[model samples]
Target chain A: DAGITQSPRHKVTETGTPVTLRCHQTENHRYMYWYRQDPGHGLRLIHYSYGVKDTDKGEVSDGYSVSRSKTEDFLLTLESATSSQTSVYFCAISDSYGTRGYNEQFFGPGTRLTVL
Target chain B: SQQGEEDPQALSIQEGENATMNCSYKTSINNLQWYRQNSGRGLVHLILIRSNEREKHSGRLRVTLDTSKKSSSLLITASRAADTASYFCAQPGTGTGNQFYFGTGTSLTVIP
Candidate 1:
């Protein structure tokens, strides 16, 4: 798991409720990412952070927001949970960016969030 | 959008048989990586091959990269039941960003 941990390993929430997932890393990597894994979709990046308080949207950033006040923690927030948001979420960390030719990423155990 | 697509979504083989999975990606990339995911768990890094390299090996795993064909293949020799899991290939996006897109993955079921 690369010393990365996600909070609320499993959660069941109601629709229209707000949910937040936390990712913490001990490696002090430069990059952190949030991704969702669904059937037929391997893993879709929701958001990523390059440094403290530096965040960016990913391909599937809509309906999701992220905050990175510190280097080791990145939070993904769903303003309003929906049934479609019920999926396994994973957190990943990398020592360097892919464009820099360092592309190895380590993933967390994942958090299973279910919306009713 | 996904940068890579894996062929043969599912595979089944005997313990002693070999399994090969292929991945095709769009656009140029600096490197490609393979990962394995067990049911209900996070992925584990397997091997990484750079664009400048043709083939790379690690233990029983062999990976080949064909930049000319925009494809790569992962071959697992002497399969085992414990090897049953989903395998995915990932590559950095074409743009200058750091995002890495993953393929749909191939589910391998190794029979004991």
Candidate 2:
């Protein structure tokens, strides 16, 4: 219940078209992450932003990009949507990485995207 | 690059029974955490256990960690229909930052 919300709860786009998913949080968390979930692959990290205007690639960053212009918003974009890119995208937030010990991650409701 | 894989990818149990899920990691770590996801909703934090601890309890939840085996288990006592969801375990990744690697997850279906 970290006050996280993802836009376009459901979407369908044609292949080769551009698509973007937005994640917004009310909490001023320091870290934000984007992940995609597939049938057998589980949840794979796509991109994450530690702070405003600072982002980095994740395990499955290919064909995907992210931008964070503020503390509350994290955006994931598919330059050219592909059938393989269809999956459920989830956004997460954390106060810290449990660097010193342990921390919890809050997740958004999630967005389901489909490509044809 | 550490990763966690859960056993018995899917489980089914009757209400009031006990449900146990196991998570195995590739590399040793100091801490591990579990999360639960209800179908289409997001994931909710469940519990956490550190390396030095053998067992920890949170209400109906019990978490046990074995560093020697690099594995952890979660037990839910007196399961209920509401407990039907997917469970995942996570551990810190290779880098020093806040990256974490999560397991493939175990889907539990509590029969009413």
Candidate 3:
């Protein structure tokens, strides 16, 4: 199994507070992604990094931002938390040599955030 | 806004029974993959089927993809209580990047 870990497994905060979730990987993979899961909705992409310092937004990147200064760490930040932002967040890393496809993603244990 | 949708939002089955989950995508994909998730945890990659391939298997898990119909199905045979988890289908976006669009997921319950 790939070595991936997510920090701050659970958190609860005020509506306007700022929250940061961290994803760390030991696999030295080139691709890293952040996603959120909610009831009745698929896992939606928030942000992703293809290389160090290279990141892009996804379908639901409205209130979130990400930064990757190193190959092993990807950080996700919510500038101002809202009730709608409360969901289980996941971090994933993909390698090109996995199998049939050029890239296959492996996920880290998620972080559960609740904005009260 | 979702690229893929899974059928049968939830399923409950007895141990030793078969559980089949289906997923459908809206766009052209390079490959489709399946994942499993325990409650409030990260997803685990189960299998991947390429656009040109029709079927693949790993142990008791069988996956079938119909690119013409833009659909795929995951079958877990002889289910056990340990097989209880949420299943999701992911379609890799068309490009060099590694972004994956996921389905809503089907929650499975295996009653022992």
For model 1, the docking class works out as: medium
Model 3 CAPRI rating? medium
Across residues B1-112, which tens digit of lDDT does each residue of candidate 2 receive? 3558898799999999999999999887778899999999888888889889999999999999999999999999999999999999998665533667889999999999
Candidate 1 lDDT over residue span A38-113, tens digit each: 9888898899888888888888888899999988899999999999999999999888654655767899999999
DockQ of every candidate structure = 0.70, 0.64, 0.72
For candidate 2, the per-residue lDDT at A37 reads: 91
Per residue, candidate 3 scores C-alpha lDDT tens digits across A23-114 of 99999999999999998997999999989999998899999999999999999999999999999999999876565435678898888999
Query: Tens-digit lDDT track for model 1 on B1-112?
Result: 6657898899999999999999999878889999999999998889999999999999999999999999999999999999999999999765434678999899999999
Docking class of 2: medium
lDDT for A89 (candidate 1):
96
lDDT at residue A55 of model 3 (Cα atoms): 95
Provide the overall lDDT of each model, using Cα atoms, as 2-decimal numbers.
0.91, 0.89, 0.91
Q: Cα lDDT for residue B108, model 3? A: 98
TM-score of chain A of 2: 0.95
lDDT of candidate 3 at residue A110, scale 0 to 100: 88
